[model samples]
Target: MYQADIAIVGAGMVGLALARSLKEADLSVILIDTTPIAKPLSEQPELRVSAFNAANKQVLEQLGVWQHLDQQRLSAYTQMQVWDQDSFGRIQFSSEEMGTSELGHIIENQSLVNALHHQVSQQPNVQMLPSTRIAKVLAGQSETMLMLDSDEVVSCRLLVGADGANSAIRKYANFPLTFKDYGHTAIVATIKTAAPHGKVARQVFTPTGPLALLPLSDPNLCSIVWSQNSQQADELLALSNSDFAKALQVAIEGDVGEIGVESARMHFPLTMRYARQWLSDGLVIIGDAAHTIHPLAGQGANLGLQDAFALADSLQKLAAEQAAFHQARQLRAFERARKSEAVKMIAAMESFKQLFGGSHPLKKLIRGVGMCTADAIPVIKQRFITQAMGW
Candidate 1:
């Protein structure tokens, strides 16, 4: 059996980040994940990507991961353009209005993960366990023990479930969740274009769903996230690379001239899930394990990163007060501090998804009015920019 002061059930970004944060405070930490880490950031090719808001970048800097990332590979979007199809509705945002240098950075997902893992590896107080599956989880009076597939047991004062949407630890804790399937799938891939993205992230809303082009490190290369019904997504993915690129070029209104596919397309079901509770007697859930929001706004990873930061801060505060880390009161403080933000984000995404997906005449009217209103109100835009940057 392996014993530690804290055990994290997921070695993904959120888990690894929290582990690094905890170890910085001199706490013993163990990071376990079912899937083995593939490779280091510098050695891996681009597979998936994430947009890092300013706040998240600060967190990464604090964890020493940002310094490990190649500076040239980071893309900063300073502007955004959003519009709806078949309408004169459009909304635009500029970082200048927010008094910021840039809106956010677009980073390769694998590279970001590897950077965090590298930081964790360098931390002496943190133990890394990969390709290890949790077979059983038992919560004791003062500690929790996880039985692994390797027949080893891990005991710790606290347990964190960061294992993603279908979290086994969440199931073992009997956490309740509300789920809604949007009857849609999201297609993600890279696109090469003749025109530069100009540090702008654009999203076009259509009757089916949203089609977004987020700027990549290469000025001419952008990442596309197209949302649509299962049938349409199936057809799109089934098309040949050339045909798919042609169709996608039109879907995004061909704003970027001469678009072509640069990577294999991937599709994932669109869903919204929220756990009824975020904390239990001896366990805490973070990241996708606690909530799953619509990716339409590119805020999923940001929200998860916020969860990790909040928990890490809360625990640090308690430890500074010389309080026990595993106390229900201490854990509840973490939950209470984050629950409001989590619920607000989840609701906002759901509302946006529904408002954009509906076909009612009133809904169409509202969409147009909403964009115009947002554009007209400086306070609204400021608040929007603030929220988007996770401020």
Candidate 2:
């Protein structure tokens, strides 16, 4: 059997980031995934993208992976506008207020993954096994043996589950998960606008749900996440491209002008998942394997990146102190800290969703007053800026 200090399952963004972060720990790492990672780079923007805050960007920088990302594909927005539909509640902010160049960047998921996979591949201490998955996980006191489909067996001192929402590692380890069905289906697609986005990220809260128009590198292009209840989503998805564009034009109230579908529409149900236990005997989970939050605030990926960063830092310190990888106390502490952050984010999303979910007059009035108040007050605005920028 092949022997290593650590084995990480799932070579997606989060998994690759974790492997890259551990490059300097002088520990042998084997990264495994069923899918081939870091596929050929694409010049065209992808349908799935993520907004990265400063803190997460810093994490990538520290891992020496940020410099590898393509500059042309990165879209930086200096402004943001959020408002309630058909109400006097509208709020807008700019980078100038915070004395920053940008609030954040929107990058295609594949773009970032390619960059990270490139960096991780260079680390001599890391071995990446793509197109191979763990067929069986044999547990033991000192180590665990991973049986692969190719009949290759590997032993590791610690096992990490970074595999996404339906993580096989998480399931095999018997980690309990607490989840909530948001009853929202999100339609995502690439869109072209008649009006230039002007480097602004905009979101509108409608009676049915929320719609976010995320600016892309091209001034006239954007990636949209239009979330609505199941019934509404079904109707919207059934409409023809032309009809849907008309419907989108009305829903957006012409904020970005005419809407043209530039890519195929794809969607998935929204759900919040939190693993009741992130640490198991001889195993631990991170990223989506640990928890998943609502995308309304765009904190899901940022949160997962943070988890990998923190765990890496913890592992480095532990190694410096000559501590065992499976020491109960140290592992537990790491788990607690990351879990707390996830809980806070989950609570914030639920509260925000409920607060703007309905058309109740009283709630609308409260939202209008609150948003306007936050916009008008520098202190309150600063608080929001701090959160959005991940300061």
In terms of TM-score, the best-performing candidate is 2
Q: Relative to the true structure, how large is the alpha-carbon lDDT of every model? A: 0.85, 0.90
Which residue ranges in model 1 land beyond 4 Å of their true spot?
Answer: 41-45, 358-362
lDDT of 1: 0.85
Q: Write the per-residue lDDT of candidate 1 for residues 1-391, one digit (tens) a residue.
A: 8888789988888888788777667578889988886365544236577888999898788778899876778889999899887666788989999888999998887777777887788888888899998888878899998899999999998898998999988888888899999788999988888899999999998888889898987889888889898888899989999999898777777788888888888889988888988787678899999998888889989988889988888887877887877877778867876777778888888788878885678888889999989999999988888988888
Q: Candidate 2 residues 38-59, lDDT tens each?
A: 8875566799999999888887
RMSD of each: 1.8, 1.0
For model 2, the local distance difference test gives 0.90
User: Distance from true position, residue 54, model 1, in Å?
Assistant: 0.9
Best by lDDT: 2
